[model samples]
Each structure stands twice: as structure tokens, then as C-alpha cells.
Target: ARRVVATLSIGKRSHFATARVAMEAYAKRVGAEFVVVDSTAHASLARWNATLHSGSNSHFMKLPMLQWFLEHYDQLLFLDDDVLVSPFAPDLFSSVPCEAFGAVYEGYHKQGWHSMHARSFCSLYGLA
Candidate 1:
């Protein structure tokens, strides 16, 4: 049996709380384990080297926590707090190639303003 987990980083943003609730409900409906990494607490953990900043971009600690989760779960679906999972959404794990990570690509043609941001992310993470 393949064990899968849904992971999210919870920050201090008011809007994120609403998304968290929806994500939790979605996880329950899918019968998947939902893990919330409290970004506030994670930032406080010095071992992770996260700066104590109160913003949505303060996710430096997620890398370590995600690594920890990989040890236990066969697959991990990481969703941002702003992401809303529709009940009709397909099983993402089934579509992902084995031994590979998956992410939605928001291309420049789709959303121009965010293209530079996406490019920066790709460059920083060395993604193709």
C-alpha cells in the first residue's frame, strides 16, 4: 500500500486560515493524512535557519520539514495556503511519475506579472 500525505505551511496570515480549513476538509474527504507545519513555530526553530519574519514568503523552514516528511510518506503533496482543492480535483499522486516531484507550472503566457517570479523560483531551485 502506498502511504500519501498532504502537507501545508501555515503562517500568520488571516487569509491563510480560511484556506487551511478548506484544505483540511479536502484531505478528510480524500482520506489522506494532513500535516500542517506551523510556519511561526518552524521559524523559531534555529536549527532550520529560518529568519524570524512575519510574512507569506517566510517558508525557509519548509525544506527541512519536507525532508523529514519524505522519510515517512511514499508521496507528499505540498499545497500553498492560498490553494483551494476542488472536490473534483483528480488524484495528483497517480499522475506524477515515479521518483519525481510534481508542481503546477504557471507560465508567462498565462500570467504575465508572475512570470518573472516563477522564473526566479526556477533559477533559485535549479528547475528545468
Candidate 2:
């Protein structure tokens, strides 16, 4: 057995079934369970607001992974739709070991297109 089980959250049932099926097929080949956390745009977003406000506005529509985050996931990953996973995913979860962690991305934006607005309109000049 290569892995125990890899868990990830899904915004909806049919959002990425094709890719999910491919992943499920691979995981089955290696004896693993792919847990899909069914989530929503409304409920999850509301929860995100309740838990965190202010800077949360920066991320816009994408549902933050905290809603469907599975604590048991040894190396819990907050993923988005555009991710590409290869069949040879060896050492996928070898390095991470922390209560909370995220890579320091060097200028990358992954979401809908929107124009940058004037900070004078936003509180704290949105320096947050």
C-alpha cells in the first residue's frame, strides 16, 4: 500500500468529477480512499465570514478551505480547481509537519479576474 487515504474538499458534487474520477482510479489502484468534502458557495462563505472578516474580502468568491478542512488529514492541503496532479505523485506529502503552514508564493494570483481598486475606499487603506 503506497498511501493510507488522501482527503480533499469539493465546492460542489460535479465541479471536478472527471479529474476526481481519474484520481479515484489511481488511488484505488494503490488502495486508498479519496474523501470528497461536499461544500457550498453560500454556507461555506458565511462560515468564513463568521470565523474571519476584514482581510477575508481579499479572496472574493472562492470558498476558503477552512470550512471543509479535515483535521485528520495528516498534511491537509487547501486546493483550488486549476491544480494539476501527475500520476507519479511520489513524496507528495513528505515535508509538511505543522499546525498551520503555507508556502510563500512569489507573486501569484489564482482566481477570477478583477481590477485593483483604490485603497482609500477600503478600511485601514486595506494595508492588511
> If scored against the real structure, what TM-score would every candidate get?
0.60, 0.41
| Candidate 2 lDDT, 5-53, residue by residue in tens | 3334454534354445445654565455554445434443555555555
| Candidate 1: tens digits of C-alpha lDDT, residues 27-122 | 666666777766545422443543444344445766766676677677777787656555467777677854998888844455565445445544
Q: Best by TM-score, which number?
A: 1
Candidate 2 local lDDT, residue 28: 60
Q: Lowest summed lDDT over 10 consecutive residues: which window, candidate 1?
A: 43-52
Judging by lDDT against the true structure, name the best candidate. Answer: 1
CA lDDT scores, all candidates in order: 0.60, 0.43
